[model samples]
Target: MGRPRLGITSITLVKTLFLAALDAGAVYFAVVLAWQGSWGFLSFLLLGAGGVNFLLLSHKAYPLRYLFPGLFFLLLMVVVPVGYNIYLSFTNYSTGHILTKEEVIRVLTSREYAPTPPVRFPFYAFGTPEELYGVVLWPEAGPLLLWPDGRLASLEGHQVSDTDADGIPDVLDGRPRLSGRELLAHYGMLQALRVPWENGWLRLATLREFGYFLPQFLYDPEQDMLVDQRTGIQYRAGESGFYSPDG
Candidate 1:
């Protein structure tokens, strides 16, 4: 009788230690979930931890030894679907619903317009095909260096020489201008490059011409409408999407 009582005490001690360790892990997970603002997931973890502790520690739950199987199925049926739904709510789940309303408004408002009269300048492409190409624009204030990242620098005292005697300078700070053959070699990439400006972008119209481009559409938040600059068309936002007057 004495030996059996000692064995039961030892088993109870082991069970208590195991329960404590499990509870500690659950608390750690709860803290992490709370920090991440996942209150729903924290609540679920707490409920599961309580249920497991009750099943293992309570004498009244001894007859219901098969509770774990039921609990496992319950978690599968409830927790998985809940988590998946939460994930889907934060994603672009369907077509025509790609961006949130705020995100769409932000993108629309960032659209910029060019000046009333278009401004164009003569530019020469420099740098090898293997590197990012840079442009030298001949502004009224001598030559200006336009980096690939849209930064403008005045090359006033830089050794820019025009050996050809054309209006456009041929050399910039000792680097010879890229020839027409070199420009044509990387024509596709050069044409696609867009340099940022005050109100719009400077795009390569031709090998010698860099033209300023303005945003085609302008959005008004208060009116919730998009106005086309060239055609003077106003498109109002509807339940389906933006619709024109003709539509």
Candidate 2:
């Protein structure tokens, strides 16, 4: 042998730190899985992570690392999905009903419709371009103040003022609002925002406006059917996993 390595060498220290970080992430995900009631997937994750950790730590199991990567991928990608598909075969799983009854109802009821002559609100952002603190919606009705965290506040409480008199409020709660090119940087966060409006929601419709929308379908649990508000047609869930028009 050329040289013998010490137990607590720099390479060993780096390995220890890497493993500790990996374990921390595993614990965090394990807690999330437990909270979400994903027990089977959680068990697989715990067992797989535990095995990897043990194999890497124990000197006797060093040789297994060469074969471990392939085995891990095989079980995770191929075995788990195959097992889940087999489990689904016993139930009424098909194209339309891939999800549970409650899930299907939730999806249908969540669909939205944009009203004719849509009320488009011009809004302005507050805080740094990288991250937004709040926004002011200027609809014809009135001014509305809202935060990215999904909380709405009164415009009066924010000490609002239009410094440049550009129609869009320039200052709110002591923060100068972002405009033009600066506002574009906050696109990722703003796109996913949904604010409750009337009986439905108002969402980011374009770069310049937030559009008000209404619920497209109303789910009646007592009748187990979805009623289309626009067409006034009722569609009932059938055994074939599709919602056919009620006769």
Candidate 3:
């Protein structure tokens, strides 16, 4: 009699689904990198992803399936980088000599400009110092519930009571409103709190307000400099990296 073949198991199905998801994500990311003109990193990503697919899915690579992953990452992360640095050592060490003028400009142009007349919203505090929550009133968007861990949600949908009808809700869900003095205790933790807004951030500007900030760095190709919006300073590429008015 011929040997019986095993049917597809639950574990095998889950593994197949997971691998498919991983490859799909890899393909999407590779496309993004290609569009961004990051060919060097894209090549590395493709090489690693291809190797992983071959090792995990191919019967021929079964022996090295587990071994290849660890080995491949070690080479990609450590060996390849160290070898590249060693190769760069053979070339001139000076930044101006090793890097092209455009490359220098690209490195110095890395800055973000916070828009003028920043978006500022008056916010009310809720919960407590240990676990804080806030409500920001935006003109167009109404009230937004801001959580301590950076979660943002529409306050209109959530159950909140306006006890005094002061426009600001007194109690959001079970968390009671906190007074300005009570909120003083939460000020330290609140400082670093930021919520995503307009591809930038909405962060605490003061105890009563939150403000929006975004990337605004403008690079002047003719001047070969990048302007800092905050300080209104222009910076050019120096021998080491950047030459700024502050320097």
Candidate 4:
């Protein structure tokens, strides 16, 4: 009588169980890397190698010579990348560190903005039924509305002229006007505008020409600090995190 033999079904079941466990582990690590978003290229290379390894290991009848070629490919894919990463960790590698002089200069220079004399003003919003609108400036100078003709209304000094017969100034030259939803259809062109605010400026922060966003805090590069205009406090960045300027 032949020795008792294990069924082929049992062997297949064992293979399936091993592959399932491998797949679960791969999925768990992938999720962790995705959440961190820092693994960078190594994550992609490993996932590819894992796929190839699965394919090779599942083939039950491969000769040893064929296995050597697959093993070589697997090493090339996995081992080479890890060696490269270990090499990079010891070198000077950072945003500006790797950059050439010209590239570094270009980046450093692009962050500057025109320090226009600060202009601050109190702004009120006017919305139209068509989702278009404009801002009315009070105690400053004029009203800037998104005109139906795809132009900006010059209501600044026109606080007296009745350009429109709606009992309001045709523009700012007349009297403060109410051009809310009535003029919303033209708001598509009402891109964000940087209007002079009190000693500084108020920026239109939306495409709809609605809300205003002011730089409530000022960043001083000279001192490497951020000053909160509202709270009258300064903060600085450091190795631990942002901390009060006093510390």
Candidate 5:
């Protein structure tokens, strides 16, 4: 055909090396995002994939050198972070160790609140699939109320009492249901609802107050400690994952 292509194997080897570099770079940035909990991890991953696509299609476009800058960026952002995390995994990087113990302890002792009883309400969800917008509630005890906007009214001919505070009467008489943002707002109403669903009411319970509950672990920078709300215990990094009452 065209002077019989020569050095084809060498060209293939160069292409392989470039692709491998891109893959390695992508993996690196992905790990970095995970470690740092950085916001742009997804962005870096996308960039890496884009780089691979660019390299693959470089020959099809004019001025192939234009793609080199992008390839360089992918290597720096993705490959470096991945390699760093791999290095971290080999050492005592977990709890009681230098780098991660504090965060581990903080998570073990976060505070949590139990929603009060009478929690269950006949509920529905709404919004444009992207964001949860709002909710409306009819209690089984108090009133047929649309919440969030606090729009309240009595459903015509339907009586709200101890049995059916949630205004959708036991008898369905063709009432148009709440939708859109109104449904999204229902979650808050679900939490705020004082009605008992089965047996438990939502209450703020920590080992410090209620003996039978647990806390969500969150970091307390000032105290320099991890508080376990479940067991009513606090663990310090120096204590090596052990929390004693006296300590």
Candidate 6:
């Protein structure tokens, strides 16, 4: 009888130590969650930890001895969703939901616009494959140099002349202009070139035409509204994850 009592005491001691270790791990997890500002998850963890310690350590709670099943179900109910939510917080979960407020502002402001009765110009491609340039020929405004930076300038003595009368200028600022064959070799890239114009962009519409385009929506941070550049319609950000004029 004495030996049996001693064995029982040793088993109880081991069980107490194991329960203490488990509770310590739970407390550590709760502290981490608190530090992360996840108050909701931290609350759930604390509750679960407290319940587990009480169930395992209390001698009067003999009927609650089968605590593993309850603990497993509690973990499923609490941990799974909290883990999934944490995963989503790091991802671009959806279209508008993906980016932060500052990122969205930067993206929206990058769009450009060309005013009504658009400023169109006849342009010619010039330069080597390493550096391509544009010269805009405004019928009444004379020739304006279109640099890659979107700057349109008229140089005092740098007038371009079509000496060969091929409708394309032969020389611009003493640099030989790219011929048909040379231009054709890099036609794909040259066609996609865009330069800044006023408050919008000047895009290569064709080999001869440059078109101006403007931003469709402009965000006003002060009023928290998206103003349509075309119609002047204002759309407020809605709680339903979209912008609407009605809101």
Candidate 5, superposed: residue stretches over 4 Å from native: 1-90, 93-102, 105-133, 138-166, 169-175, 178-223, 237-242, 245-247
Listed per candidate, the RMSD to the true structure in angstroms reads 7.8, 10.2, 14.5, 11.9, 13.3, 8.9
TM-score of each: 0.55, 0.58, 0.45, 0.37, 0.30, 0.51
Order of models, best lDDT first: 2, 1, 3, 6, 4, 5
Candidate 4 Cα misplacement greater than 4 A, ranges: 1-136, 140-160, 163-167, 171-182, 203-214, 245-247
lDDT of 5 at 124: 31
Model 2 / residue 121 / CA error / Å: 0.8
Compose the digit string of candidate 1's lDDT tens values, residues 29-93.
99999999999999999998998898887889886658788878877999889979888877767
Overlapping backbone residue pairs in candidate 4 total 25
TM-score order of candidates, best first?
Answer: 2, 1, 6, 3, 4, 5
Q: Which candidate's TM-score is highest?
A: 2
Better of 4 and 6 by lDDT: 6
Residues 36-114 of candidate 2 have per-residue lDDT tens digits of: 9999879977987888788889988998989898987998899989988998877756444468778877887889888
Clashes of each: 0, 0, 4, 25, 29, 7
Question: Model 5: how large is the Cα RMSD against the reference?
Answer: 13.3
Error of 1 at 118 (Å): 16
Question: Which candidate, 1 or 4, would have the higher lDDT against the true structure?
Answer: 1
Error of 4 at 74 (Å): 20
* lDDT (CA) per prediction: 0.76, 0.82, 0.75, 0.52, 0.49, 0.72
Q: Candidate 6: give its CA RMSD in angstroms.
A: 8.9
Model 6 lDDT, residue 113, Cα: 62
- Could you tell me how far off, in angstroms, the CA of residue 147 lies in candidate 3 after the best superposition? 1.1
Per-residue lDDT over 2-96 for candidate 6, one digit per residue giving the tens place of the 0 to 100 score: 55455778888988898888888988898899889999988888887777777777887767778678768777999888988888877768334
Which residue pairs in model 2 clash with each other? none
